[model samples]
Target: MFEPGRLHLEHSPVQPPDVAYELIITYAPASSQDGPSMHFQVTGHIAGQPVDESFDLAADLAFNFASSIDHLARRHGLPATQVVPISLHRQYDEMFADIQHKLGRHCGDPVDARHLGKT
Candidate 1:
């Protein structure tokens, strides 16, 4: 399920037998000190292991949050390719727009050069 500032994903692996997990992601604009960034929290469980982590990303890199979630899935023992599916592209677009609006970011705003190298 995808909401304006929240996304919830649940997955159960048939091949792996009893491994099932849920991932909930919430995001919001960061404080002024964070400088045009978004704050994110991922909380849930994977294969009976508790998962609670948070991170912040600059406006230009915020859209890649899904990839971050994929990394977390791998850390919890799920195969790289078998992570939760974010098939609703439309919902993602909505969430992206919402984040940009909250951050007062425009489509053509200049991106941080340092972040470009990281990508």
Candidate 2:
């Protein structure tokens, strides 16, 4: 569900299966001298245990999901709207790197898109 100015992805252990990596993303974008940055906090469960994490929310999502983003943004009447091109695939790659850096678990090779409910 998308609220006033936030986008949310909801899921439960029952939905994600065994490992139970369920996450909710709450983020806002910011324009800085360095570059654009997004602040996001994710709270959920990993293997049925609490997993709390945060990061500079880099824009990431499947191309097919753009309409979802637009829907939310329009619903909220967000201003200064602009379409910024970014590579979701690359962001996903970095996500694993960030996950490893923060979780102390190498999330490469072992994480299959098939297991993630993706083809």
RMSD of each: 2.6, 16.6
Q: Which ranges in model 2 have alpha carbons more than 4 Å from their true place?
A: 4-17, 31-33, 57-119
Task: Evaluate model 1: give its lDDT.
Answer: 0.76
Q: What C-alpha lDDT values do all the predictions have?
A: 0.76, 0.37
TM-score of each: 0.79, 0.36
Clash counts per candidate, in order, are 0, 1
**Candidate 1: tens digits of C-alpha lDDT, residues 9-72:** 7876778454788989899887645367788898999988899988888878777777777776
| Total clashes in model 2, counting residue pairs 3 or more apart in sequence or in different chains | 1
Q: List runs of model 1 lying over 4 Å from the truth.
A: 32-34, 87-90, 117-119
Q: Positional deviation of 37 in candidate 1, in angstroms?
A: 0.7
